[model samples]
Structure formats: structure tokens, C-alpha cells
Target chain A: MVAQAAWVVLLLLGIGLLLQNDLGSRLALFGIQPDLLLGALVLLARRMGPLTGLAVGFAAGLMQDGLMPDHVGLNAWLLMTAGFLCGHARESIFWESSVASALIVFLAALLHNFAQGVLASGFNLNASLQLLLRSGLPSAAYTAVFVTFVAYAVPRVLRGRD
Target chain B: MPAPRTPSDRAAFLLYIFLSFVALGVWLSPFPSPRAWVTGAASALYLPFRAVSKGVENLLGLVVEREGLLTEAAELRRARIGIQELREENQRLRDQMDFARRDSLHLVPAWVLAKRSDRLGSRVLINRGQLDGVRIGFPVIGREGLVGRVDALEGHLSRVRLLTDRASAVSASIDRSHVDGIVEGDPVEGLRMRFVSYSADVKPGDVVVTSGLGGSFPPGLPVGRVRRLGLESGGLLRRIEIEPAELPERVQDVFVLAAGDSSRGWGFLWARPVAPTDSLAESVRTPRVEP
Candidate 1:
């Protein structure tokens, strides 16, 4: 369990490094970059159950807070909430179909961006909704594209190894 | 799909609430830089990543520098070719200056302004005219040998008909045999010596020069070598083909000798003495007058 948690932290660190580099900006689609961190959270919640999801999500958020201190603990709460909701439905959702898995990631990313915007705007509902309609749409779509491959490959590789 | 409210689930829920409340406390805390410890640990963990980032930046800089160097190399290549041409032109001008001094000749140096060739053969326009002592029938020569004679003149420009022109003719003789013949230009055969009898002692490789018979051209000026020899159809004269002393197409800078007694001792150009036959000079026109 400790090894798995370490892997999760390391993975997020890799994603954070990419986000801070020129190569990451080059991969942006129409000015909206994919949120791979949020996609990983969605995958963790769906596969690892709510308890594990909550702990990992909390740690992920704290790391984010460490990088950006402006919103010190906001990411922790928001990421945990996202993890709980995805894990709640983990037993019911079909994880075999890539399309269904991608859709789940897309919706998760959309809600995550909207929630972050609302909290950042101090609960300004109009600005949060506007963000969801504008940058959030393309950003979620981009994350979905990234997660689709992850969802398809991770399950097969883990199953094959098992 | 809700999991039963087992002991573990209840404990996890309580844990989630505890963590969230603590995060909320920190958000509302008054202390600035409260997460400095967290940020410090994270920065320490990322030390290697920063080094790698710098390496990536340097590699990109090298790529940009490579492209700039390639552009600079292409510009330098073009500049090198232009310098080579200027060097060659300077050498040619130096040789022309030397030739004028060694011969002790009066030469009016002129740059060929324009050149053209057609069914009439070749002609060139030089930037010299009657105002510059450039008269009609004045002999023009490149550093090598006879080029042509000036045919027309303007106030500041004159046209010279090249020796290879169809209407052009000069009295020349073989240097070895001292036999004179009319060297006329033909569009097909470059230069042919007519009137040399079948029994004339002329052979291939013999040097032909101006006999100065018509006094139109200086005596013993390097004309050309006899390339081929044959008998005329009637068996009366020999068919002698003379290669030109100068390639008419390539003459750029030329010197026009002021017409008169200037070419008297000019036979030294071919190491021969003046052997003027005035009887032949009277027969052929001194200056071929044409429009």
C-alpha cells in the first residue's frame, strides 16, 4: 500500500514537471491544455475504492498547494470531493469500455474545473458557470482525450501483469 | 453501488472530515507563508528536475544557433564568389597595362559597352569615339593580338567589326613561307586565306600574320595558326583555314592604335620585320569604307 502511494506521488510529480516546461505548452490544444492530474485522480477513485481515493486525492492536493500557495488547501478539499464521488460509483460503472471511461473522465474534469473556479472566485456563481462554458469545455475535452488512452492501457497492463 | 457502512467505511468518513476541517483551518489562518515547510520539501524533491530543465533549455539554444550559422554560411558563400570574379578582372587589367607599356605603342584603352552577333557575324561597341582619337579603320587589339578594326564612330562611342565578321578581310601571310594572301572572314569557316596558290609552301601549324599589304592593319601582327590545308576545286589555289588570333566573342577591354605610321615597327609583336608590298597595298583598299 505504501509503495502504491509512493507511485501515485511520483506520477503527479512527473505531471507537474511537464506542466512547468516549454514541452508542455507545445502540447496544448487551442490554448487549452489537458489536465492529466485530474484524470489520474478520476482513475484512482474509480479503481481503488473511496478510502484509498480520498487519501491519495488529499495528498495530491497538498502537493499542488505546496507548488501554488495562493490556494493552500483549496485543492485538497476539491480533489478529495472529486475522488469520493467517482469511487462511490466505482462498483457500478463498466470500466472495460474505453468510451464510457473517457466520458467519466470528461465529466470529472468539467466538474473539477467548475468547482475550482467557483472556489477561486469566492463562490461567485456567474463567473464559475462562465468558466464551465468557455475554457472548461475545451479543457475537459482535452483531458478526456488523454485519459481515454490511460484508461484503455492501464487496465490491460495491470490485468496482464496480474 | 454504495458500500455498506462497515467499520472501515465509517472510519474513512471520519478521517475525510478531519482532513477537510484541518485544510479549512489552514485556508482561514492569518499567517503568511504558512506552507513554507511543505513548499521547501517539494522544492528539494524537484532539485534534479530543475537541472534537467536547464539542460533542455541549452539544447534548444543550440538548435536555434545551428539555424543561424547555416544562414550565415550561405551568405558567406555568395560573397566569396563575387570576390573571386573581381580578382580575375583585376589580373586581366594588370596584364593589359603591361602589354601597352612593353610594346611602346599609342593605345586608346576602351571598355566594350555592348556586343551583338547575327547573320552579319559579330560587332562590339566601345566607349571611345572621334573625340577620343578613335577614327574609322583604327586597329583594335586585345592583350593577345588583332581583335578588329573600328567601322563607325559617334561622339562618345564607336563600333568595331570583329575579324570574324562576314564583311571583314585583312591581308596576311604565313610567317614561315612569307607568302601573302587575303585573310577574309566567312560565317562557316572562321578565317580563310584566299589566293595562296596550290604550290604555296604552307602547312598546318604555320603561324599566319598581317602582311601589311593593304596598310589597313599593322605588319606581322599575330593573326592565327594554319589549322588545315587543301587544294581548291580548280586546282589553282590552296584552301587554307586560319584559326583566329583572338576569340571575337570574349573581347571585353581593347586598345585601338591611332591610325597612321604607328604600326611601322609593330612587327616585333610576332618577332618579324615589316615586309610591305605597296603594289598589293594599292590593289586592296587602305581603309574599307562602309556605312
Candidate 2:
């Protein structure tokens, strides 16, 4: 359990660093990059339980928020909710299917962006709903593709190692 | 599929909500918070990565956007030459117009250090500051035209609020029609020349320039070209949207015009006789500063 926790923390830090480095901008498709951190959170929540999801989500989101100029708590709020939902869903949902994994990632990303738009409006951050959707939808699709690939390959790799 | 929510889930949700609120509160507060330090540190840690990424992007740009970049570079060179010619021409015009020598004007060159990340706010930081004689309210001009005004000053850096900023307003006139209006910046539309008389003959492609009425910007400096014209809801004033002469993305260096004779540029206008068909009332037109 301790080893798993350390791995999760390491993953969060690595993702945080990568996102902040702006590789996302280079990889942007239609002015949207895959939300790698969000994918990691969703995957973690699916693998772990609700409690671990909540804690990891908060930490990862806070790290992201720390790098941003404004809207410090906005990501934390969104990611926490995402993690919680995914964590709870893990109990009943089977992640063995790659299609389901992609769907989950897409839903998570959509929720994250929609929540971002709502929060931006509340904070008067000048991010319009139209702008949010324009960037968000593509980002969701991109992240979903990556998550699907990971979902397919990771299990096989682990089984091979065993 | 619905998953059963346990007591633990409820408690965790509440805790997360509470933490998020605390963070929100800290961000909203005007006072300094530890969160700023944390964010700054995280950003600092990413600086080397950013530098590397920038280098890689530039390399890729050379490969992919070679033609576009070359075209832009050529355009910039042409613009620089044109600006130099305009500067020399303006010097001669200034000598002819301001024969009385009442105003002292000089340009100070400054490098654009950084651009503000906030999409809503159009501001930039320059390297020149108080030590370099840069001050608040001084006009900053790019190679193309009017860029912005110095909004704030520090020991070695200054903030310039661009003409496209919502708070910025400039007294301007249509070059051909001489219709006077107050130009204001809009985030959505580039710049809007407001409160022109309804009867004023303004149209698309008309050149707009500073009238030098407000003392913030000098007279005769090009601000933008009229892109579109419309009548306001009140119908009393005509609304004119303008495309800013200076493209913010291409602006690298700017000259701060400090204490200049802006009024004297209207000498040519004064020398020309008015046509009778141009029935623009004197009250509607702003008075030109004369020597």
C-alpha cells in the first residue's frame, strides 16, 4: 500500500512538471492539449478507492493550481469531484474493457472543463462558455485516446511481468 | 451504473469542499498568501523546462513554419524602414509646424520584457522605468503606430496599458472626414471610435489618428484604420470599429514619446481651404492646437 501511494505521488509530480513545461502547447490539436493530469487522476481513482482518489485528486490539482497565474482553487474543485465520481464508479464498473476506460476519461474531462467554465463565470475570470467548450471538447477526446491506450497496455505489461 | 455512497464518501466530499473554499478565499483576498509562494516556486521549477521547450519549439518552427517566419521577418524589415522614413518626415514636419518651439519631444527606446498572460487585460512590461525617465501617462509607440501608454512605473520596469485595453481611451479623428471621436478599446472588437456625430462622413478604410486633445497621446500619430461603422442604439452618435495599426504579437520594441509637440502636426490642415460641401459644424469638430 505504501509503495502504491509513493508511486501515485511520483506520478502526480511528474505529470505536474510535464504540464507546466508547456509540452501541451506543442502537442495541442485544434488549440487543445490532452489533460494528462486529469487522465492520471481518473485512472488512479478507477484503480484505487474513493478515499485515495479524493486525497490524490486534491494533491494533484493543488500542484496544478500552484503553477497557474490565477484561479488557484478552480482545478482542485473540479478534479476532486471527478476523482470522487470515478472512485465511486469503480465499485460497480468494470475497467477491463478499453472502450469503457475511454468513455470514463471522456466523461471526466468533459466534467472537468464544464466545471472550469462554471467556476470561471462565478469568479468573473473572463473565460466564456463558448471558449471553454471549444478547447474542452477536443481536449477530452485527446485525453480519452491516451487513457484508452494506457488501459489496454498497462494490464498486459503487468500480467507479462507476473 | 450507480455506485452506493457510504458514510466515508460523504465525509470525504465535505472535507474536499471545505479545502476548496479555503483556497478560493485565499485567492480572492487582497492580502499576501502562502499559496502565491507555492505557485511561484512551482513555476520557478518549471523555468528550465520552459526554456528547453521554447528552444525545441523554435527549432520545429524553423522546419515547419519556415516560409511564414521568413515572410514575417521581411515584413518587419520593411516596416522598420518605413518607420524610419516616417520619423525623418515627422522631424521635418515638426520643424515646419512648431516654428515657435514651444514643446520639447524626444523618443526613448525600450525593450518589451514580457506580455501579461491574462487574456482580458492587454498590458506589457518594458525594461525602461523611472531611472530611464519613463513615467505614468507617457505614450508608447511601436513601428506601426500607437501601441499603448505607460500605466505604472517601478525602479527598472514599467507596465504599458495597450490601446486595446478596456480602460484605455484616446481622443481621435478620421483623417479624411476629420470627424472627431473618443476611441476606446474593446476586448472583442479591436478598438471603437465612439460619440462621432451621426452626420459625420466615416466609412470602412478611413485612416484614424490621434487628435492630441486628451494629452495622453500626440496628434497625427496613426491609431488604426476604420474597419466598420454603425449607429449606436441611441442613434445620436456613430459607432466606428477600428483595426489597430500596431499588431500586438509582432511588437518587440517600442519608443516612449515623452513631452512632445503633438499639436503642431495640424499645420497642413490649417493651410488647406475647406470645401463648402463639407458642412461639418465647428462645434462638432475639436479645435486644433495652433502655434
Candidate 1 deviant stretches above 4 angstroms:
A1-24, A153-162, B1-4, B50-106, B109-291
User: Per-residue CA lDDT of candidate 2, range B1-291, in tens?
Assistant: 233367787766676667667656655657666577657765765566567667887999887798887899999999999999999999999876766342445687998998862445677888886567665667899988999887666657777888888877999999998889999988778799998988999989999999988766768889999999888999998889999998666778998875334333212221122222221123125322211
What's the C-alpha lDDT at position B20 in model 1? Answer: 85
DockQ of 2: 0.18
The CAPRI quality class of candidate 2 comes to incorrect
Provide TM-scores for the models.
0.53, 0.41
Runs with alpha carbons beyond 4 Å of true place in candidate 2: A1-11, A19-22, A123-127, A153-162, B1-11, B41-291
Candidate 1 global CA lDDT score: 0.76
lDDT of 1 by residue, B15-47 (tens): 788888866666666775656766665566665
lDDT of 2: 0.74
B243 Cα displacement, candidate 2 (Å)? 87
Please list the C-alpha lDDT of all candidates, in the order they appear.
0.76, 0.74
Candidate 1 CAPRI grade:
acceptable
- Please name the candidate that would achieve the greatest lDDT relative to the true structure: 1
Please give the fraction of native interface contacts (Cα pairs under 8 Å between A and B) kept by each candidate. 0.39, 0.38
